[model samples]
Target: MGFFPDLPITTERLTLRPFTRGDVDAVLDYRGREDVALYLFDAPLSREECALAVQQRILQTSWSEEGDKIVLAAVLSESDTLIGELSLIWRSEDARQGEIGWIFHPDHHGRGYATEAAGALFDLGFQGADLHRIFARCDARNGSSWRLMERLGMRREAHFREHALFKGGWDEEFVYAVLRREWRNGG
Candidate 1:
């Protein structure tokens, strides 16, 4: 057996659980928007693509080995509306390192939902999985994402300058990381 948090992890305002087949439409609400996909690896998904993505996400609920991940749907606890998604990818089992990322509905911005959801993931990674370190990366131009990482108590570790070509242009990247000690110390 490997590290896998029990499903339906709850925070103050959101529930993080495995994606269900019925979640396609809700996922498409944000994933289908151009602005939402601006910093993501993939472009805005179509309805069909969202369905496929949800299907893929449904099977990615466990992190049992290196390269495995837990992809969770972030739903409103009050309304049960799917507003976003969170992921924790196991990058190196030997090093006990993980990578985290998030995407939320544009309409749901500014309410700290991303931070709440990501905090839960941090707990799972650090407390549940016993990971030594967790990191997040975002496009340098994505202020909101890096800011959210900061709010999660992550420190900026690196700033890569135009290292990779993305969306037909040079893409600068920012990497942020937190250690288990820092997270457990309430950071």
Candidate 2:
């Protein structure tokens, strides 16, 4: 069986599943917004870009080697409405390390969906993939992102100042991580 034999992982309120062509519109709703794209590496996506992105994500459901990434659509279980996206990258096979990231629609902010979804990802990494460590990085100015990381029991491992130029200026970054032992030990 594959790392995650379960295709659609269900949380209390959301489901993390592979992206589909039908998800273009829902995904575009947030990916096309300027505010949502602010901290992201790219600018707001156009319709065509969103469509192509979904096409790419559709094939990113598996992991077999270092650098391989799996992207999942976070959908509201009751409505099957796509509200955000999450990703896990196999950073190192020898170190058993991975990276996690998430981007949710602003409308869904303040809800516990992101935290729940992240926890689910942590499960997949630690249990499903037998990973030793999973980490996440975010712009230091993004309070919500870091706060969510903390809520997931990930500790701030690094604070990089002026890490690189982002959005036309120097940007600071924060890296948060949690070990498999900690995750399994109730934090």
* Top-scoring candidate (lDDT): 1
Clashes per candidate, residues 3 or more apart or on different chains: 0, 0
lDDT of 1 by residue, 82-137 (tens): 99999999999889899999999999999999998999999998888888999999
lDDT of 1: 0.93
Off by over 4 Å in 1: 184-187
What's the distance in Å from true for residue 6, model 2? 2.3
**Could you tell me how far off, in angstroms, the CA of residue 116 lies in candidate 2 after the best superposition?**
0.7
Q: Return the TM-score for each candidate structure.
A: 0.97, 0.96
Whole-model lDDT for model 2 versus the true structure?
0.92
> What local lDDT does model 2 show for residue 131?
88
Question: What tens digits encode model 2's per-residue C-alpha lDDT throughout 48-141?
Answer: 9999999999988888778888899999999988999999999988899999999999999998999999999999988888889999999998
lDDT of each: 0.93, 0.92
Quote the positional error of residue 143 for candidate 1 in Å. 0.2
